[model samples]
Target: MDDGRAVISVLLADDENLIRAALRTMLDLEPDIDVVAEASTGDEALSKARAFTPDIAVLDLQMPVLDGVEVAERLREHLPNCGVVIVTSHGRPGYLKRALSVGARGFLPKTTSASTLADVIRKVAAGGRFVDPEIAAEAISAGDSPLTPREADVLEHAAEGASVEEIARRVSLTPGTTRNYLSSAVSKLGAANRYEACVIARRFGWI
Candidate 1:
């Protein structure tokens, strides 16, 4: 399939059609890279990844059904050989932290040029890591999150004005436990209430 050159296969997962098209076009022009599959949601991305088994996956950080960080974690568990790169418009410090923790090899903003993305893909495929310098600096300044994972989960569920019972149902926790987590999160952030906690967590990209 290649003139004695090893081509890096890539799976692109972004909900935006235009972005996908542009990326595919850009990557297709590279001699050493091939766009093997594309998906519009996180679930679809996972399914296609399983089917295609691409060498690398370039994922949008905020896909539907499951976020890119969640997808990256699943891929790490199910397809350890496939490297992951997360690109996002958000570029929040907490989001960057979560992506890296999930074993993503590359993290960059959507504003990155196509040539830069190609270089990142090449680097990640070669068992290297890359993170945008500005994002890295912001993450270092943001420090670590104070809330526990459970507490952060509850806060995220509460972000959309969900009641404690609904949050419990979504997270598979008891209503009382959900309330406790929410309270703990609020107290940790010095927020007056659950809503304020959500705002603070979101602003800091903790949720």
Candidate 2:
């Protein structure tokens, strides 16, 4: 427990009540770690951070109000010492890359063991780093070549539920040109469909 002089305070943010409860339980078992506060959304995490002043934040990638990437950015700007650990079910390769880009120090799958979770928390608190093994291997294998800027712009507009015509209108491009860009992006990402392309593009920071 490090003699109680130093305890790693944590702020947990997840959309599900049960998941938050479970994480609290597991972290409580560690004498040197404490759950100082809980939030259900990115906004709540940011709002409560000043009061809690937790040493670490365990956040999910997706949540209402704001997303984890934005939360991590704000934390980096406002709480420089507070480490971020992405705990999510979306184990997509793009997500892992983007999370690291956004200043997250650790990545742990939602399916990771409780012991591993505890270890990651402690390690990050003590200025160590961690990343999910599978994600690490995949990120390495992929070698990080993002789509072109125009392709990223196309994908971002498309991901926002825009139709091809609407995407053209928004991006100030001809409909046929928009379609071509979308098609090229899909091929470059090796995505089976536009939806998959959006996901891949997002992870690669193209959008």
Per-residue CA lDDT of model 2 for 40-72, tens digit only, reads: 988999988878889999997767656677799
Candidate 1: misplaced stretches above 4 Å?
1-4, 147-188, 198-207
Model 1, span 1-207: residue lDDT tens:
456767999999999999999999999998999999999989999999999999999999877667789899999999999999999886667777788988999999999999999999999999999999998998887778887656877788899889899888776678998899998999999999999999988887677
Q: How high is the CA lDDT of each candidate model?
A: 0.90, 0.82
Give the Å error, residue 61, model 1.
Answer: 0.5
Give the least accurate 10-residue stretch of model 2, judged by summed lDDT. 142-151
Q: Positional deviation of 22 in candidate 2, in angstroms? A: 0.7
RMSD of 2: 6.8
Count: clashes, candidate 2: 0
